[model samples]
Target: MAGPMISHSPAAPPRPGPGRRVVLGRRVVLGAALGWGAAGLAGCGAGREPVQRLRLATGPEGGPYNAFGRALAAATQGHAPAVVPLATAASVDNLHRLDDGSVELALAMADTAEDAVRGRNSFGRPLPVAALARIYVNYTHLLAPADGPVRTVADLAGRRVAVGADGSGVQVVARRLLETASLTGGAGRVAEVPLALGESVAALCAGRVDALFWSGGVPTPAVAELARELPLRVLALDGPAGVLRARYGPVYTAAEFPAGVYGLREPVGTVGVGNYLLARTDVPADAVCAVLRTVFDAWRDLLREVTAGARLEPRFAVSTGAVPLHPGATAYYRSVYG
Candidate 1:
């Protein structure tokens, strides 16, 4: 999978080729499209009932989650249960809100979702959250100045690193990667700083931090803009990918950033994690089904706003791994496959 690198050209997004499953590196896209109309969607346990107002927990401002959330909210302008995007710290924070009934929906990294459901890592207890869909893959980006002293993961030892904002999936993975490189736990520990995507960019440009970690869809707008302002390279984490997967599970996939992204002459290896659309168990099944219809039906319009939006596929959408599917989502998928 490609890391977040903004595209400047008007190149068309990739579509499924001939086969039933089109393999692109570690990800797959279904050739069959879910082009069902309103009548078909109504049969998926909801019978055309309008959905209620729902608040979706999205990431911090200028992040992929927030951008996609706002786009989705706009798509539901005429639909019921108007989806309001709630700007948050992403992943862990979103999950907490879902558990506490602060929000009805969320976008979270699969790794973080797994942790919350299992009551491990960032969560203090098991959360009553379930998957609506495995939305897209998020590439882990370890960014550093192109002409800086740090060239590899090992070089990050004893240096300051912006490990994303508090209660974010970026921080969870960043700290673990540091631990894997033996850059934490002792004298060689990295000086960790928590900052949102925009803040991290500014800090890096001002030399306040040596590196920053971000996990988002390919060509994240903020990251792309940062690249144009300052020359930086995404550090490779191929070796650590295996370690993380071995320790945490298959949530972490070994992937790479393609050449020409961020103007790189070569691909940079990194870890990839699936991003899931989630909802609390208390969310009504009909409402969840309606939201799924909105997401899958309006994907092309969403594509114009976020690249991850273009990745909405039937087969790929159902792969939530350990996170169990919401009943409404189950009904929606059954209708599609049937």
Candidate 2:
């Protein structure tokens, strides 16, 4: 799928599509929209019984995860365990909170989830996490100074580069990109600086670093501000994108950054990584089922807030590589697809 570009002219969100009830062979039991059947089944599981509560870990304020999490929380208000969006440091932090039992649900980048499952990268040990659904795509941004000497990701060798801060998912993706670009752990490695999005922008504009790697939705406020202050150059990420997808999962894809977000006249070739809704494995299947039901049944409401949320494809839900589907989510899918 092409990386979604935010459209200035918003279209009315589409109504929730038909729902599936029972799977008899390959024929799907499409019936009365999403809620009719899902609503009935909501109380069938262990998720939202009476006053059961849940916390949804979202990205920092104003980020995509926060916005979508808020929409999701609102939709599930009377459905299952109460879901409250918890503003956090984003992907890596979300996963950490999920493992520590501080939160029951979270939003995380696919690569971050992959690393967590394998006990590599930022994660110290294997975490029992599973996919609730494959959500939206996060574009990988390789930004450099407009007139800087660096022209490509590989050229940053010996130059200063800002990955994200400690315990941030941006850092995980940044490190992976650099390793693939051959800019780390070698004779000509670049100088690494870790900072948050806003800080990275300031550092880049102030000449603190020659390049910065930011992975996020388009039109990130900080990047937009940086673009307005000085002409910026976006390095092409298509080169290493394929390798990343193969090493990771189909969650990573070759796509172009949307044009006009930063006053660009054309799209820039970049890589896109998906974000997922994850839950701890021990969550009741019925609860997972109820939440998934509410999520899709209220899908259109979410689209109104995050246009890219229209990409919540069902076929991709069960295939979130490296992580198993939560039993509740699996049950939901089987009932519909069986």
Best by TM-score: 1
Residue-level lDDT of model 2, residues 1-338, one tens digit each, is 35332211224333334663333211121322133355433423543444366799987776667888899888877765768999988889999999999999998988899888888877899999988787656777889877889888878888889997666778888888888878887788878898877778889989999988887766666678789998989888887888887887666778776677676778888887777899997777677777888887876676454443344546544447677666566667656544
TM-score of 2: 0.80
1-338 per-residue lDDT for model 1 (tens digits): 44231211123334545544333221211211133344324435645556668999999887888887998899888787689999999998999999989999999999999999899878888899988887777888999999999899989989999999999999999988998999887888899999988999999999999999998866777888889989887899999998998998878888778787877889888998888999998777678877888998876675554553345666667777778777677667655553
Q: How well does candidate 1 score on lDDT at residue 163?
A: 98
Models 1 onward score TM values of: 0.86, 0.80
